[model samples]
Every structure is written in C-alpha cells, then in structure tokens.
Target: MLYGVCYYPEHWPKERWPIDAALMREAGVNVVRIAEFAWSKMEPRPGEYDWSWLDEIIALLEANGIEVVLGTPTATPPKWLMDRHPDLYMKDAQGHTRGFGNRRHYCYNHAEYRRLSADIVERMARRYGGHANVAAWQIDNEFGCTDTVRCYCDHCRQAFQRWLRNKYGEIGKLNEAWGTVFWSHIYNSWEEVVLPAYTVFPMHNPGLHLDYMRFASDAVAEYQQVQVDVLRRESPDKPITHNFMGYFAEVDAFRLAEPLDFASWDNYPNLHFDEKADPLNSAVQHDMTWGLKRQPFWVMEQQSGSPGGNFIFAMPKPGELRRWTYQAVAHGADAILYFRWRTCLFGAEQYWHGLLPHDGIPGRRYEEAKRTGEELQRLSGRWLGTGAGAEVAVIRSYDNEWAMDIQPQSFGHRYMAHFKQYCRYFYDRHIPVEIVSPDMPLGRYRLVVVPHDMLTHPASAAALHAYAAAGGTVVLDFRAGIKRPDNRMEERTIPGAYRDLLGLRVADYGSLRQGDTRPVTLVRGDTAAEGHGGGVWYDIVELEGAEAVAWYASDFFADTPAVTRHAYGSGTAYYMATEPTPALMDALMDRICEGAQVEPIAGIAAPPGVEIARRTNGEKDFLFVMNHDEHSATLALEEPLDELIQGVRHAGSVRIEAGGVHVYERASLRRD
Candidate 1:
C-alpha cells in the first residue's frame, strides 16, 4: 500500500525541498525514493563523502509523514573514481570503450569497479540502515539498461575463461560439449578461448556464444551479490530489491531477483491517448515480475506522463495514467511509485514529463495523481496480503531465448513475440496466467504452455513428462527440444527430448517467407474449422500413438498433422507443428481448456477491450474490471458486490466508462 513518487532533491534547489515535501504529503504520497543516480553529489572526491543534502531531505520528508527507500549509488560511480581507473570502462563488441558520459559504464568483472561499488554500498547502508524513515534499500538502478549487460573487455574475457573452466572442469570436456570438431575450433588450452566477438562474419561458434551469454549474466549477478551481501550485513531489517525493466531479457530476471527479498519493475507502457496498444503487453510483464518471486511486487518507476529520451512519446490521456496504475495493481503490484515528482530542467531526460511540469506547476497530471492517491488511501490495507491465483502457466526460458536470438532460423520468429501470441489468447478471455521458468515445479498448474523452447535440458523435459502423466495438460509448439543446453543439435530425431512426451516426431521442417501462410483445418469430432498458419516456420509432424486434431490444407506438407493430442497416463499432451492464426489459436485453447476444466476469472469471456482479473487471500476475494476501449462497457454482475473505489454496491449490472477501473469486493462471503 506504499504510494509515492521518485523524488530527486538533488535535482532541485534547497529552498524548494520544503515546498516539494509539503506538496507530496498533500497529494497523499506516503513514500519517496531518492539518490539512485546521485553518486557525484554524494561522493565529490575520490574518498571524501557528503551526506548533508541527503540527510536534510530524508529528515524533511520524514517530518512531512513520508518514508524513504534509499538506493545504492553504485549504478553511476563518481567521475573521480572512473578517472582514476580508466580500465573500469566496459568495452563494446567492436572493442570500443563505453565512455563515462552515461551511466553503467563500469565493467562488472573489473576488480577495481567491484571494490568501489562495494565500498559505496556499505557506506550508504551503514549511514541510513537504522534511520526511522528508511523503509527499504534498492541494490542498484536497472541492471542491464542501455545494453550494458554484455561486455567484451579483457576483464570479462578473463573472468569468462575462469567461468568456463569451472563449468566444464577440463578443456577436453569443454571441447566435447561445444562440439568443436566441426569447425576445427577446438581449444588446446584455457588461454586459447576468446569471447564471441569480431568474427569474420556474424556466425560465431554457437556453443561459445551461448556460454558467453551465460558468463556475462553470471558476472552481473555476482556483481550485484557483492552489494547485496554488504547491504544485508549493514541493514538486515530492511528489504532489498532491484528495479527491472519491462520486456528486457538481456539478463535472467529470475536469477537477478534470487537474492532480493521481493521483486520490483519499471513499467513504462508508453501508450498515448490515441494509440491502439495491446493491454496484454503491460499485463504480461506484470505477471512476469510477479512470477519472479511469486508474490506481490512494487512498481518502482511507474510512468506518470509521456516518456522521452532519444525520442519523445505522446502524452497519456487525462484518465489513462490512472488506468495504468490500476492495471499494475490488478496483476500483483502492491506498491506504486510514479517515475518522478517533477520533470527535470536539464539533462538527457529533460523532456521526460512527470506529474508536475518543468515549470514546477501543479497541473493536470499532478491533480490526477492526487485523486488516485486519495482513492487508494480509502482502499488501503484491504489488499495487503492478496495475490493472483493462476491455474495456467507459460514456461519461460532465458537460455532458449538467447539461443534463438543467435540463430532465429527464419525472419520474424521472435521468442518474446511468440510468447505474447500464446498469452494474448488467455488474456482476451480473462484467464489468469503465470509466466514461470521451466525448471520450476509444474504440478501446481492445470495447463502448462511451452512455446518454441529450442534449448531443452533433460531435467526440464522429465518434469514436463511427469506433469502430463500426473493429470496436467501441456501444450508445446514447433522447434521445442531441437537443441541441447550446449546449443548443439540433438543427436536423436527432431523434438529430441520431447519426442516421447509429445507422442509425435518431426519428419522435416522449413521456414516460411514473410506474408506467406499455409492453410490449416482443425477437426473436432463433428466439426472442422479452417485457419491460416506458418508466419515463420512449420514442421511436418508424424503421429506416433497420437490423434491428429489439425492438418495442413495446402503446400507440399498438406494432409500432414499440424497439431496433435496424445493422452499420457492420466493427462493429455498437445503439440503444435506451426504457428496458428489468432482464430485457430483461440479454437485450440478452447478445446484444451474445456478438457482441463479451466475457466475464465469472471466465469465468462470479457467483452472486447475489457480486461478482468482477480486477487484473493484465503478469506476475501477482489475482482478488478478494466475498460481500455474508447466507449463505455456494461457488464452483468453474477452476485452482489461493493465497488471499493467509489463505495457503491451493485448487484445486477454496472457501466464502466472508457479508461475506467472498477474494484469489487464480494459481499458477506468469506472462505475459511
């Protein structure tokens, strides 16, 4: 229930601090985050430290009844530190150094940089760990922002060599795992290994490239662990988190969040007033962040107005910002903090508008935010322990995503886009879904969807097989289990590890050109429906103790199984040989969910442009209905409920305006 803004006392004059604090309190802001990017201000010299300004702001905000979430200033080291150690700069793929003009320039593997980061984090934690107003600590700014996750510097190269040595144990094992015999690229010694950069062409050894990605991700995680260890020692009572960016997959978010107490994300949907955007784009990310820890999270940097950097985006409509905030909460966000209280007057982010304008005038956006805060205050404490209960989970794999990026096989075959495509169907029907990693247990979910997971581990395959055998439905698509964890092709048939579980084998496959599609016809007992297929790739699937639910209608692969279903011990396993059209996917999901007895959250499909979700503790249940369309939506209620936002009771039906949100609490019904 923490509601606030990301304030920057360092960005304003000292005299304006009091006024800002008062205005924030009046606007119902109960918390504020500061000093995530104020390294230079905190540490002016190499070893000198200054906390006068920060101390004053924290004390002033506390007096005004606002708590503080202090962040480690390690994201941006002081110019003095960078100037002293020039080798700390991260080198790009072309061996060009990323200079100090922007943030996150320091290489994570650099020894000097790690030491300095640890020193600054410990100093900040020790100074404010016991402060009455300090509530939590953020480890660093966005970990992989600005493509800084991958560094080709000598420090990273050496660290990567050590990492490979640790993983493979010996050079001969590394050679065998990487399949280095094909290109005669076998390494004689550990020193001979190099990063996958500056190759003669874009093609680097697939095994080497995949390992480098893992090594780089580990390096970043280890770097954060250093600060995490220091903060836990210094501030054991405070919670820790790192703000992750939406749709960012440069580093493994699950791994990054493993050390923190909970998860938080920076949500900037960047939707304008007139733009026709998919609401699922933001909803899926919220689910992803929530799935990181499987708990309620915080929106660390919620977009208040138009977001701008290299290019400016259109401003949100009057009620759009409030709707976006409600959307975040609808998923799993227990706390919401707007990106900034006021826009900056100078710097690259000068044009990034906040609640208040650049003139520091409390205008339309500020009033809207104030109204949201007021409404939220009335509804506080009721939703403190509630979280989404999802029966369907979409399996996510960072390793497979990275492997696909290395060799996409065909154009427009994106990993994330494919994930969204499948999730969108469930979203449209208001079915609660969770995005989970494949390594996690699958028994909790009734249906598990694994889409285009190219690199499959044996343990993950075994888990899926067991889940299906134990009365869970599993849906897998083409190119799944085609490669091993080492990024090499499986020695067995296509769909290597999944062959037995899926009850099918891929005879052959081919990539389709853009704007070309093969027709498919799905047959269910007494009816058949035709739909388009193959926007990216398709596989000719041969049935093995399975039933063909769909078949290609045209092209050389006509009459072949495009989709199949096989009943394992107590459950069913479904497989897709090609990407289906939206209509076809809907039909497929309908049949699968019907068999699994899964239903939408509202007991029926929601109207177009309307989104529905539910959150509940063991006692109380809350339903969120949002209308993202341009016109009003009228929904029929199944039972009596209280609309908490406006404190109205509705039993028959309710009309929601455009860009409106309604939160309903069931009346007189409590579970034991």
Candidate 2:
C-alpha cells in the first residue's frame, strides 16, 4: 500500500520545497502528486515553455526517497491559451460562451484545444516520462467536473452531428432512431440536426438528448486517449490513471476506466451541511471505483479535514482522520493520498483544509496522518494485489442514468439514490457487493440487482436473462427495461425484454409526490406483513406464471401484486414494484439473499454501525471490520485469529473501539 498527498510545488516557493518534502517524510509519506493544476506555471505563454521549475521539484522529491505521480495539466489551461482562443471555451445551452475564470472551461470538441492539449501532454511525457521517480501519470484532474460536458458551441454541434452521421449513416435512420416525427423535428439533412438545446418544454427528443450524452462522454474519453497514447509511447513503464469524482455522471466512468491500467477517484466525505456523513456512501464509491477495472484502486485525493469553501465546515473528530483513511483501505484501496499536503492560502479553495494548515505547521490532522502512514507501512505488501471477493453484483449503467436524467418523471425519482439504497441495504448487512456496469459478466455473482434501470441495451438485457436462466438469482426494480437502446418506448410490456424472465408485467403504474404512501403487504409461503412504499413511483403488476410475494394493501391498486418472484429456467427473478424504505429494502434483501444462498462473512452479521469487507489474494482471506459509530462495539469470534493492527490473537471475542478497525486473517484449522 502507498501513502501520499496531492502536492503543488508551484503553489509554494522554491526555498520551501525542501522544507515541505522533509515534513512529508516525517509524516511517512512515500508518494506525492504534482502538476495537476500548474499549466500556467508550466507554459506562461502560448509558445514559451518553462520546464526548469518542475524538473527541480521532481528532483527534490526524488532526493527524499519519495516517488512522484505526475499529472497532465490540461484540466487547467494556461490563461494565455484561453485568452488567445476565446472561441475555444465551452458555450452554454443558451449559446453564450462560458467565460474562463475557472478551470475546466474548454470545449471538448474544439480542434485547437485538442491540439494544444496533445502538445502539452506530449511535451510533459517527453520531458519526464522516463524519470525513475515518476511512478504513474494522472491524465487530468477530473474529466467531466462542473457539468462542462454538453456544449452548444459550433465545434461541439458539428462534432455531435458528425458522430450522429457515423452512427445513423442515413437521414431516415436518424429520424427513426430519434422518433423525430412526433415533435416535427424531422431533419432533411445532416446540417439541420442541432444539439438538443433550449427545447420549448425543457424536454427534447429523448433519443437526441441521450445521443448527445453518449457523444459528449465519448469525446472526453477520446481526448483522454490522445494523452494516454502519448504517455504509453514515451513512458511505457509507468501506470496511467485518472482521478474520477465520486458518483460523477457526466461521463461513463466504467468506459473511461476501460483504457487505463487501473482506476482511482477523489473522495470528499464531509460534504457537510449538518447532515451526518454516511460512511457507507463512501464505501459504495470506493467499491464502484474498484469495480471499474475489477481491481483494487487508489483514493488519489481523500478529504483530510473540514471541506470549507463558501460552505459550512466542520472539523473531523480526533480519531476520524485516521479512521477514514483506514476505511478506504478496508474497502480495497491499495493507495490512499490526502487531497493536499497543505491548504491553499489563495484561490477559491483557500478554506478547503488539508493535512497541514496554511500556516505550514503540523496540526492535529498532520499528526493523525503521520500515525496512519506508520500503520500502513507496518502492514505494507501483506494485502497488495488482493481484492474484495463479492458474492452479489449490482448492475449500474450510465446510459440508464442518462436516460432517466433526461426525463425523471417523478419528483422523487433520483437515479443514484435508488442505486445507493440497494447497495446500502446489502452493505449494511455485511454482504459484500460489487457495483458493476450492466455489461460486465454476471455469472460469477450469486445474485444480481438492477435498480430503476430505465433504459436497456439489447446485449446487456440478453446477458442478464441468460444469467438468470442459468440459475443465478436476478432482482429487477421499478422503471426497469421500459425503453429500448434507442431511447424509444417499447411497444411490448414494461420491462420489455425481461418480461419472460420476470414472469410479470406492469399493469398500471403512477408517480407519487413527496410524502405520499402506499401500503404493501407481503405474502410469501404464509408469511404476511405490511410495509409502506411509493415515495417515488409504484406499479400494479399482473403475474404470468409468477407467484405474488407482496401486494398493495391500500388505494385503487389494492390487493394487486407489488412484488413477485418467478421461476425461470433453473433460477428465479424477483421484481420490486415500488420504492421501499430502508428497513423494508433490508428485509427484502435478506429474503432474496436467502433464496440466492448467499451468506454473510464468517457466518456473522455485522453489528449496527459496523461494516465488514473481505479481500482474498487467491489464497487466504483478510477480513476488514470497521466500526463507524462513535461508540465501541463487541464481536464474538469462533476461533483464535491474528489481528494485524493490534498485533494480537483473539479466541472468543473482541471489543472494537469507537471508529476503530480490525484486519483479521482467519485461522486455518487441520483435521487429524
């Protein structure tokens, strides 16, 4: 495991570089990331370049035995470049050029911008690519931050049209795919097709909007590949990765991760607004990032202290800084780096706290970070190359999310919220889960859950149905498979392609306003109970060779099926017809897990406020037990086992302190 921080040598004076490096070494930091936002410092003018400063910084860090992860500073274009090409900036849906003052303002499709970006990346690679100190290359800071994805500029419009032409080929096919006849949007020529911007009712043709999302995401990936190709060509030995933002939907993270060596993401837990930071949310984010390449990932930029920038800021408790760092490791993070070495004394992030405060003094966070670094070093390499082995895989798709975002029919219909709810339910019970794209292979999983999947790709749907038919349990939630890949409504039943496997069809459904409720009664093998659902939407389902597990208990759809299970081929498919509460979802998950024959770790259910994760190196399994709450909790172990952190062996039981973690290597028994 690697311990590091995002360091900006350009932000500090040359005289202080050694001082900062010494402090980092004192804190046991082994790696430091630089040059992510230092484009202006690298190239002060359009044609002029300055490499001496960065070369010195890299040499300084290398002298201290700390490796470096260099970033392509394309995220922040130099001010000179932006000023020279004002037309290269991204334009809003209102067709007004978004002025530059912030980073990530460049239009993705601008030819001049692409050329400049490639030039910079090539120059950086040629200069420092082969340096022994450079271990990895971060392509960009964050690919699609600030919703700068879909642009209305002429460059983007022309690129989008070209992309459409390549996809559809003919005008008639384009019209049919976009369902253009209904809105009188039929295009006579390719030039007539414009961006789905400024629609009259705020909702354009669904297919048009969906394709725009695809094109924008593809453009970002293609732009990244240009840099990737250069880095691979010049510095073939160093691994390459991009720091993805948590739950960022602008670009398909999974697809972006496809070309990289591995995956990584920035995590800011305390987006504090008086709301309790749910540690499970961060866990899911970590799992999603790991699932990108089905390998362990890095927390490239982790929150060190209070996140304050024109927002509410709350300092972490004494033990929280260390605890959260370990929490990242617990969830398959091979490398954990703090967001910054020191808080910036200037710019919009002046208040965004770091391990070291702006005063350059080692504060409480620095102390905690030092302790964490020592602990990680002590346990180094024991778990490297090990990955979380999950029994359940939840299918997540950016295409479905994009489709839903284009038209979220209900006020409470949040794409990520539903997906998180499903993850939270299983995760809270200590049942390990992997959040994968719909296209990933599903046969290895004991069960598969798809939540509110509004759009369906034909290949993915076929793969899912095959998995279910082969005896793997599948769970499909409401609003799933309602639209085709072209974003057109299916003429068949709701959950069109999956209807046969589901053995149920949506008879009627309605969207519910906030606080609206509907009573659903469970009826499975004489087990009967009532639960309230329908905060977002509810469906009245008609069974076709399926057994009703639950039915609506009130309203016009009274006694109608709300949940059903069908035996398809050698397996079963479960359908959830409404958005259930956390408790209900957990209860249902328990039943589903039972049917799927999936069991919790070591035959134990994690205590409340505690999470359990298991990672295996294709040999032995290491269990990561994390107590999230502020109070201590006790656990009973079946046999004596080694606890890595405490360097103790426990037989009967152990008490985990508040925000404490225990990594245990299960004991092996012999039969004589």
Q: Which candidate is the best by lDDT?
A: 1
Steric clash count of candidate 1:
0
TM-score of each: 0.97, 0.97
Over the full model, what C-alpha lDDT does candidate 2 score relative to the true structure?
Answer: 0.85
lDDT of each: 0.87, 0.85
- Per-prediction count of colliding residue pairs? 0, 0
TM-score of 1: 0.97
- Give residue 217's error in model 2 in angstroms: 0.9
The digit string of per-residue lDDT tens for model 1 on 402-481 reads: 99889988887789988888889989988888898877788888999998878989898899989999999999999988
Stretches of model 2 off by over 4 angstroms after superposition: 524-534, 603-605, 667-672
Per-residue accuracy of model 2 over 1-672 as CA lDDT, tens digit each = 689999988888899999999999999998999998888888898778999999898899999989999999999997778878988889888888888788898988988888888899989999998899998999988887877888899998899999999999998999998889985888999899989887576778889999999999999998898888988898899899999986889899988999899899998888757656889879899889988998989999998977887774777778887878877887789999998899898988888889999899998999999988998899857778777678899887899888889888888677998889888887777777898888899988989998877787789888888998899999998888798888999888897888898988898889988768676666533323545444578888888889887767777887888788999989999999888876567777788899998877772345799888777765667888888888899878876778888899876768989888888886322111
